[model samples]
Target chain A: MLENKDPNRTDLRELGEFGLIDHLTQGLTQSQPSTIKGVGDDAAVVDIGGKYLGITTDMLVEGVHFDLGYTPLKHLGYKAVVVNLSDVYAMNMQPTQVTVSLAVSNRFPLEALEELYSGIALASRIYGVDVVGGDTTSSNKGMILSITALGFGKPEKVAYRSGAKPNDLLVVSGDLGGAYLGLQVLKREHEVVKVNPAHQPDLGAYHYLVERQLKPEARKDVIALLEGLEVTPTSMIDISDGLSSEILHLCKSSGTGCRLYEDKIPLDPMVISTCEEFSLDATLVALSGGEDYELLFTIDQKDFPKVKGNPNLTVIGHMTDQGEGANLVSRSGSSIPLTAQGWNAFQGE
Target chain B: MLENKDPNRTDLRELGEFGLIDHLTQGLTQSQPSTIKGVGDDAAVVDIGGKYLGITTDMLVEGVHFDLGYTPLKHLGYKAVVVNLSDVYAMNMQPTQVTVSLAVSNRFPLEALEELYSGIALASRIYGVDVVGGDTTSSNKGMILSITALGFGKPEKVAYRSGAKPNDLLVVSGDLGGAYLGLQVLKREHEVVKVNPAHQPDLGAYHYLVERQLKPEARKDVIALLEGLEVTPTSMIDISDGLSSEILHLCKSSGTGCRLYEDKIPLDPMVISTCEEFSLDATLVALSGGEDYELLFTIDQKDFPKVKGNPNLTVIGHMTDQGEGANLVSRSGSSIPLTAQGWNAFQGE
Candidate 1:
């Protein structure tokens, strides 16, 4: 009954998450006058009289999004809220409230839940967002967390994914690759512990990377910094599914192309050292490693001086004409096509 | 470090969903000025310019909330959206936008997800709400659907569970017990089918009951009807956890007591007949068998004349002073205290 039906019954793995979402929501027509902008953005925008309210939702499944062996319940709870808040911040809005819904198995003790809630409370307090509402229910397997963040900003100040133009500078906040590398470290340690319970592998050297994986914070500070600098991004998004995937999203939504310089990609010293230890390319890790929770945006060239040499900001690339296609300028000065090989949840871990 | 922690870690089973949520959110403080109301209400209320926006979220897990063997993906999708919208309506607000997030197992085909989205599209069309944004991911087990609904209403017109006063007449829209009874029938049929592949139990006589279970509609019409009649509810809630549980919620939140007349409870002929067939007490089914999706609200005694003879509404009870606890006056003239032995997700199916 669907127009997009495949006679051979295509696997979700073939379409991937983004392609599946696009395929499913192909013809969705928004009818509400209050809906200023709908799908295909970091967050949906609603016209609420004096300002625009940005609404975003995210779902984190247990086995898919997390592994409880190393991930503390507290950090999991905090990270869940931060991820949703990142989407709101991507819209240049300060999250005012959030509703968290969970489907948890009975295997969790009340103490464990208290730990989770404590982390949630900490995130709410630290971010200045209220835990407004939530539903708690039972799950048959591992836990699932779904969070919805609501934020507001003046209509003129809010950024959208579809506002980029040619020559706009593409900038990113903080660094990348650390969270993904942290997950690798945790996984490696988990395997080691499974094989030899008495062996305690020192994780001190990878503390920064491990912490980024376990307790990454959203770049709410980036939003504030940009505002203080009087810089309005032409387009914006949060890098959750790797920098490459997010840049592709911005380029596709804005009908533009981009050229990202490999040397310009921000990577912490720890990230670089760890990449070498693992024999992985640092630039590739920075490009496709996900869960950075960093802000990626494009700014008009005229505002470049304001953000130039800013400690937290990195000028990584610039938007280009759609016909040029998105490419990464390697350190050796060769242009290579950028593909969105980000995390595909449908693909078994 | 939690004050409520037991020397022996308390199992989640001991507290159940509601008790656990209450226990976890004990000290959650709302510091955001935009957050006018938080936590306990059907929907969180946020002041947005001239109106109050109601935000609520619900999560439906496959084995916990539905059985794929009997439930059509389309109906499940529609029901998921409707249930969330019901919360917004319970706050006496008109839902204008919704964000649906799903985590489905790879077992589901593209067509299956299409069917689900089709149902969501249908719900949005029927309810006049916009499908704004969402996230889709993979789950390890069965499908999970989480929806967040956004709605708005004038500040003065918004109904809160805490607004009920003594002497206000408690009323309900449509009938109850049908949805719960429908579940009983579906569960019976599911068991029958499990035992014999060829067995197809006749369900023609229980059409309404089965439909109520599979595809219950939210009472957006009730809000419209009340508006048309110029009747504003002093307190309101949607019947999801049975009448007894809802009444207790209203009473506790409003700091009052309630008197529900067993004889005055509205039940369809189908509900009564099915209850008899199942040898279940019709009154108990109406009182504690939840998922009716009907609006239960209280109106001031002064405005009783407006809804007194309305065919769509039935005045089943009235508010009382807090000193007198909530009770149900039965046909035998016995006053039985109401208990909230409603669905407890953590208690297991």
Candidate 2:
């Protein structure tokens, strides 16, 4: 079925973008009836309970999204599912199914994809999310992964990004910056290995940081925590970009600002030491380093004591009025304007 | 900022799949009032409508998902959004918003991205959907598009793929197989051009076929069409993988079987000629060429004439008893078992 097309040939311009997607998604296996509409509409329609439904998507690519050389196809598959479920979790909903679409180059053997799907299946089982639909094709380059996780959520219980207010105590689950440090350490070790191919630097001590970088966890715990604590956040967002940038988003969307105490910022000891070792700013890591799957949320000051100082919870900051602006109050009583940096670095990259 | 290193690079075998994802999306940026939970959990939670919310993800890779050498990014983006929307739409609801994620290598310039987004933005507008959230990253090879569309449907209006019966008519909106033929023309042109670059083939003559390939529209119109016709498919699916595959899906899910008449298969006249010119079977194109984006659905037989001969619809087949099995009866009274040749081609590719 390779069809004998020149591997090094075929300009994408030969087919318009539409032609390409059509060719790729062609012969897709559309599997369900709740999929009232699929693939060829403004939005695919689903029927969940004939009353409410759910929708979410995640994107992954080679190089920018994943390093094929360093990353295993299986974990990449698992992470793809995890990423989409993160959104579903953010919505306070449960997922039922997912549609996966992939792009691959010939560099990947059939064995490679099976490995990827193995991880996808495992994650699907663990999360109770089914792989119901997807698209797959070859790429001219490395690879791409796009998966849409569909689930059921009563519309009345759905969450939006715009509901935080002043006096809401800002809290985050788990410590921060360990993942960033993990990246730093991994990058450093990778460099060393490149220069000295035989150097067997055992990074056993940095296992947590390294693992945090390679296998991220979506905070299914917070949902359990919220259930256990019997408390609900007024507003919330995920920590994908970084801490400071996320704060700026809450402020921008909720018509409120924040006041952060430098001393109060939670930092994993491993993250701190790694930052020091690299002469990198740990505070900046907490603020701008991306990819920590923790939850940043605001609860009424009334519920503060219920979770405050609890394990896995941190009093990182407090919400303020828009006029006050988002600021960080230092240990010395100085306040600095909060900056949004996550997206900027990406834009430059 | 391109900080790169990791000891794992020294021993590829040491870096397994799970380890890589952890490294890739670790230390995510945290923000927003609606995010109750994020990456480190079963699912992320957001606040919406004064209720807890959920989000999930999907990533569509290149070659594995679509053939960019044949697909235009514009339609690619539009279809990307459509694919995500289908999952949500399957719940029988209205889609409210979407976030598109894309990975493109330097092979694509800023202008190329602009075109892709233009289609996405246009589709968003057409669907009354908003581009509220997303991710954009770099890829090492081809362009990778991952789109997550967010939608809301009242619980009652949402439908599921699980609810069909033996008596259902198995209806579908819009004609079938034009997009398949569109590819035949495009591929022929591509081969012709490959052999002799100077030949300025008259593509204008193949308007409909070309349009079907490059500008395949989503059946957003079908949702409205059904509402106007005062008919709803008992079980529905979009014609993405070819009609036969979809019929089998409905049968398998409904625990029933189906029978269809070949003479009744839907096709535009141009598709007939195009298939003939290419020395391909028109039925084969309808059966497995895929990407029609039409709706394949089942309805009560009472609703037949109401939809039959509708400009956008065709009565190609019907549902049958479970023991009947899926079969296609030709105009000459010959019966053949329907085969899943369409989806099979991708696995080989």
Ignoring the other chain, what TM-score does chain B have in each prediction?
0.97, 0.78
Tens-place lDDT digits, model 2, residues B1-349: 0123443222222323223333333422333333444442212334344343333344556655566656777777776776555544443445665656566654665446666777776776666665543445556655566665555433333333445676666655656667777776777777887799887878898889878767766667776777788775676666667888777767776778778888888778888887788888888788887777676777778888888778777777777788988889988988888876544322333
- Model 1's alpha-carbon lDDT is 0.91
Off by over 4 Å in 1: A1-7, B1-7
Q: A300-328, model 1: which lDDT tens digit per residue?
A: 99999999999999999999999999999
Candidate 1 residue B303 Cα shift, in angstroms, is 1.2
TM values, all candidates? 0.97, 0.72
- DockQ for all candidate structures vs. native: 0.62, 0.12
lDDT of each: 0.91, 0.65
Error of 2 at B115 (Å): 3.2
C-alpha lDDT (0 to 100) for residue A120 of candidate 2: 80
**CA lDDT, candidate 1, residue A176:** 95
Q: Write the per-residue lDDT of candidate 2 for residues A107-173, one digit (tens) a residue.
A: 5554566677777877777776655434455566666787776555555544444578898888888
The model with the greatest lDDT is 1
Task: Tell me how candidate 2 scores on lDDT.
Answer: 0.65
